[model samples]
Target chain A: MLDTAFEALKTFDWGSDLAALAPIEEAATASHGKPEARQDLENRLIAALKGTLTRDAQDYICRKLANVGTAAAVPTLAGLLLNKGNSHMSRFALEQIPAAEADQALRDALPKVSGDLKVGVISSIGARRDSAAVPALSSLLSDSDPAVARAAILALGAIGSVESAAALQTALRAAGDRRATMIDAVLKCAESLLASNQVATASSIYKAFTDESQPRIVRLAATRGLLACASQPAVRSI
Target chain B: MSVIKKPTRRDFMKTTGAAFGVPYAITSAALGNSERPAASDRIVMGGIGIGNMGRGDQGAFLGRKDVQYVALSDVREEVRDKSKANVDRHYNNGDCKVYNDFRELLARTDIDAVHVATPDHWHAIMVIEACRNGKDVYCQKPETLTLREGPLMIAAARRYGRVVSGGSQRVLEDYRKYVAPAWAGEFGKIKSINVNVGPLPQLCNLPGETKSEAIDWDLWLGPAPWAPYNPKRCSGSFSINGASWRSFSDYSGGGMTDWGAHHFGGATFICDVRDQQPFEVNYFDDSNGKYLAYRYQNGLTIYHNKPKTDQLLIEGTPGEKLAPKPVPGYKGEGGIYGDFIECVKTREKPFRDIESAVNTAALAHLGNIAYQLKRSLKWDSVKQEFVGDAEANRMTDRARREPWQL
Candidate 1:
């Protein structure tokens, strides 16, 4: 049955009977609940990616890999990162693989990919909250492609570390395009910072935005953010 | 081919509201306050299980310019058609997406949030899936059919960082807002509360299977154990006035949890039972040998008997006390609906958040176990279990049917 499902995965396409791929779904389910079973399935999925397959079939495998894949599957997924046809699905799996190797693969691909592919990989790095990618992502803030630059700032903010914050602050002071986008990213970083109990760091970012000198809406959000931070229990010493 | 254009509940709300002089609201969908957001700022919304309360709540959401109900989903084709028409009627362009399954609605990246008004059995799965799909959730109460689902529901919301609130409709579900001064000493001291809701019903042993093209019975029973479908059992007849599934313990805690979610939520608010339970629940069997009343640690007794006025009575220690004027702002007609939409925009938690449904939901389950035991039971509110009583504890979590396992 499993072999039949894998065979179906080899030629899987949109608008087909999904139940025919039930064994794949079953394996993904089994892998989610049991660590040992997931390892076995994960290895098999990675190896399957190495063999020839249709784009949709590779996608089906990637979709399942998003749930069960680890660092061992990272290289195969990363191989698809710059492929125009497969980058989105590849990044989808890598963004969630729960391994530094997956993050590094995405960060490593950032310079190698271009256009929309570059933008998608940069966004995946943010979704992973990969702070180590901050230096690489920070450099893209001045990229010729505004979309790529926007993705970099957003990803850096999602990383939400003091270093990422500093990079964003420097970018905000200097960037000519998408100033609103930068503010949105800064606020996102502020929120992530607050969730981590970096109240002082978050408060500084909020204070910078709350300056009556800033936009009224930005000031309003910053004001609320400051109050929300104040309302919680006192921040613990770092 | 039959489409229910307007649910019977819409008319029921008007008749019931006017007769009782209560604010069971269904205003025109065009009125907007100064606080109403701009068109682009409007939250894109969808409804899952647009049946009774779901449709009612969706109507209220349609009233707000800050919300756009872009899609409707339900297991029943009739329900989908009806809800699509309802939403289409509100939007001039009359373009509203419809799906037979909720997962399809979740897959719509355009959907910013979802209203999960599925049955007690389907609530957890639908809401959890919605949360994972990055949609804020406005789910109907009781939060889960059983106790174990409480923590899992909360964990899902927290993990995904989505704002989720239960449809306890605190503003409309109970007497808390209406009788505020009662707890604030206008009534001296609330000695006991006669919560006017029926006792738990026996297992659903409805005679025959109800098969019809109007509803997909299998989908309606998602997460609930496979059962023979009866019209009285599947999707429920809106003409019947209340969900019949509430009478079956397999899907609900009967009318106790149905109305218990309302009354208990109100009682706890009035009694200040936050972070604690009754510590005791004893049902003195009625003439039919059914558990009928219970007491709490605060000497506040709650009787399961129906009230003369269809409202719970908060009895004072000495004598009759004046029920002060109902709070005006607090009892906004369909305010909970607006509250969830407001939370989605502000990224804030609703006043009566999903977590607020936990204790009252727990009360409903505990009350059922006590009724089944046909005796008084001691409760451990903190641990959320029966003290030294494994039998009662086992009743807290029911076995989930396939693909619905938490």
Candidate 2:
């Protein structure tokens, strides 16, 4: 039955009859919460990724890997990151993987991909809050393509930290008409820092906005951000 | 039980006036100096804003043979006529009165209770006015459009000493009967709660179009900033089932505040954070929608998480630790209905009263403020304002256009 299910999966059409795959699904269900049993099931999914399967079949494996994919699944998903058709679902699964290798794979994919795919990779890095991507995101802040530059700004915001805040401030010089957009991202970065209990650093970002030279909305936002920092308790857990 | 005799015209006026703290002279004048019955053995209901939820509420109230829907009101001519037809069908006659304006219905001296299901903007004023008119109110969720409205609703309910239930109905009698055990026992000392009520509201960007003639578009736009009517903006989909004035910032807070009330009202109680508030919110923009999150001083986190596959059943996934058994032919946790009827009889607060709805809705407002500002807000929940954030504080109340001003 398992053999039949795997064979059926090789050509899986989302629109096709899927009842034969019940045994495979049951096997996967039985393996849930049992990591060792789950790995065997995950291996089948991983093996399916390497076969001559339909794009739908690959997407199915990628989604399943979101819950069960591990370090071993990283290399395959990493390779898919360059395959335009598979990159999205590849990043989707990779984003959920807890391995440092997976994070490293996403960081490596950032500078190599172009257009929205590159933006997607950048976003996934920030989703993981992998602060290591800060230098990479900062370099892209001046990228000629406005969307890439905007995505970089947003990713930096998502990975909010003293370093990312400084990177954003440095990019502000290059933002020109996109200054408001940059300010929005920086405010978010400041918020993330406050949430992480780095009140002093977050307060510093807000304090700069409070300067009379800033735009009125920016000043108001900073003033409010400063008040929030002042109200924090001694500890934090976000 | 001895059947109590109904009050005469003079006694009825006195009873109604006494219930709402209105002077007898004013009460009689509002009733057009017509003879009126002060009390009735059966509940004499007049539904105001009988659009979607308003009609649903009437259906529930009608389940009791004793509920007599004497009058119906809606700004739209079609809705009022349709609702009036439903009411007439219940009585098996054309005895139900209909009106395009709610104030006309409220002025009827025979009405003992009201069901208000207006758009988000009209909720506070209608509910407050109904309370003043000495009618018990079953208002819809998101009891107020702004923080200012919540207090006014509470004041009216208290001042009038009328039974008022804000419609986060899950907290009413059936809600307590089912969810109480889960809170006290099943979900032992809940360390955290995930509301999973979906994302923050987005700005209304429904493509514009020509307005319709059947709907009173201007009346529907009551109090909201005047903008040209679009079919999407008006009676949306026309079937009361499909109408949604929610996406627009003018009328509603999208799905966040709408369903958030249902989830937040119960989550606060289950998490043992009732009457308390989460200190700050943390949001991550996921491009598709925001991953909105909040942190309470007690170390609990509440946020929206779209459920994964196989995570829901017909009665659905039990949250925190709710295990509600399916009772055949039973409407889901008929708590708000039970509370309203009981309160009307006893002249007491409904179990899920205005104050509780106000608190839960306040949380949703906070989340909206945080989302709008793209920052975490340090809320002084006691003051009901952001600590020093005027911009965030300003968002707590929208500027109502003239005539709708609070």
Candidate 3:
């Protein structure tokens, strides 16, 4: 019963039969109890990933693809990295892919994805803690949207990149009250980077946050960040 | 019946009004108003199940100058005596009465209202009888044992013109200030209502016990279908041994009907979906057998489990978290009792009024019916019956033993 359902899902062009796919999706997640049944479902999902379909269908297939968690979908998801048209689906798919494949895809996508979509993709990559995507994510700290810039700064912190610290410091200098949330993000990222032995990067982030002319809360958070980093006697000595 | 020694006036005031901040001068002023009934003119109050919950209800009425504690009754003699003493200790007028049987207490013309705090199965009969005898009722949550009995209870309340309220206090307290705004698109087309009532503890088997003199074995069983007098069933000592009599088919409809009445009642009330049954209902019992989920037509999924969470989570489109913040006063056991009394005086329907609570009870009953039949059964809320499922229909209402008809 499971094999037939999976086969039906694979061969059926979701462009024409989008409604019918829901049951198949439900059955895939439903308690099938057998490992062979799940594998059959995954194979059908992989087949669906290869097909051309509407955005909704692609989104649905992408979700199933992620759920299947196969190495095969990595290439398909990676192909969408440079393709901004379905970047959300691509980012979602990339996030679910194993770190080795996802990191490269996210790094490639970061330069190409502009605006809100770029921020989303960078955040997704950062959330996965793929250090390879750090350079791309760090570049976003200077993006147009304060939200996106904040997200990028936080992503850099998560990745703990020394190269990203200088960018965060520059972003912090220009950021006034208009980007308090973003500034907090940069301070946090710098703290994480410092903990990873990237002290020069952390010190620059700390200085930016502690600038007295900045918002009182931001300065306090920055001071707190310095204290946290300084708590390590070896780092304090420096 | 043994006459219990009563506390003095000072002790009585200390016991009852210690937490009530109203000074005697203000109380006297409030009582002096011509509109307010005198203590002697106030309605006499009696409690049937004066256990933990029952005593709490009794205490609320005890504070009201418009009510006098007249009688106390419980099958458990200890609860009855203790409750009677508690009432006397507060009133200190030596005018209170006590009875082991609730019927004798209800028959007294002095008592104007009865708070039915017995287990779920006993609610219908007690409430209906109370109404028939011209007594207003405040029955605890999940107001009926089964779906069929809810409408009958509603009919009894309406037919008798007696004010009846379900013990779900969230129904009162600025719920409209929270729910109405959400329903009016303030929350931007509610995507889903996730009601998590936490998880129930593991069921335990009953242990061997020596029957104590405090309990009445036969009377405690009451209208429930005949079973041997097990001390574990009555004393709740078997709770740790996984022998939850209430969780079983014969005793109670598990936690779904028990807690679902309170949690699901809040969800449906907030959604303003009203008495219409869901277009589709899917129930899922948790893998651990400790929880049950019921998804309704409005995309609201109610989870009835043990450790009740944020009573109801009303979710919507991005950036809109517009469900009413749960009011502090609308929580725990006493919350409902206080709300019911205020509504009774104001002549306003409470948050868990009979009409809405009946709908909640109906939903819980349908979930149980679906589980018991081991197949999904479509419900007609208007007609209040299973669509074409005759076997499922039989479970709607149980037969009352001789002379207990509604």
Instruction: Name the top TM-score candidate.
Output: 1
Give the alpha carbon lDDT tens digit for every residue of B192-264 in model 1: 6666665574444454453776777767887564456677675453222234786676677777777778877
- lDDT string for model 1 (A1-238, tens) is 7778877776665434567777775776545446788788888788888888866567768766765677899889888887877777787577657678987898889889887678878767775668788889899998998778877886786677888888888989887756766776687677778877788888888889877777554676677678767865874322
- TM-score against truth, every candidate: 0.55, 0.52, 0.51
Candidate closer to the true structure by TM-score (higher is better), 2 or 3: 2
Query: iRMS for model 3?
Result: 28.7
Candidate 1 lDDT for residue B365: 77
Comparing 1 with 2 on TM-score, the higher-scoring candidate is 1
**Whole-model lDDT, model 2:** 0.70
Clashing residue pairs found in predicted model 2:
B12-B38
lDDT of 2 by residue, A30-83 (tens): 564577888888888898899898776786677567656789999999998887
TM-score (C-alpha, index-matched) for candidate 3: 0.51
lDDT of 3 by residue, B102-158 (tens): 879877655677888776768887886686566778887768776767876775565
Query: By descending DockQ, how would the candidates be arranged?
Result: 1, 2, 3
Candidate 2, residue B149: CA error in Å? 1.7
Instruction: Give the Å shift of residue B74 in candidate 2.
Output: 0.5
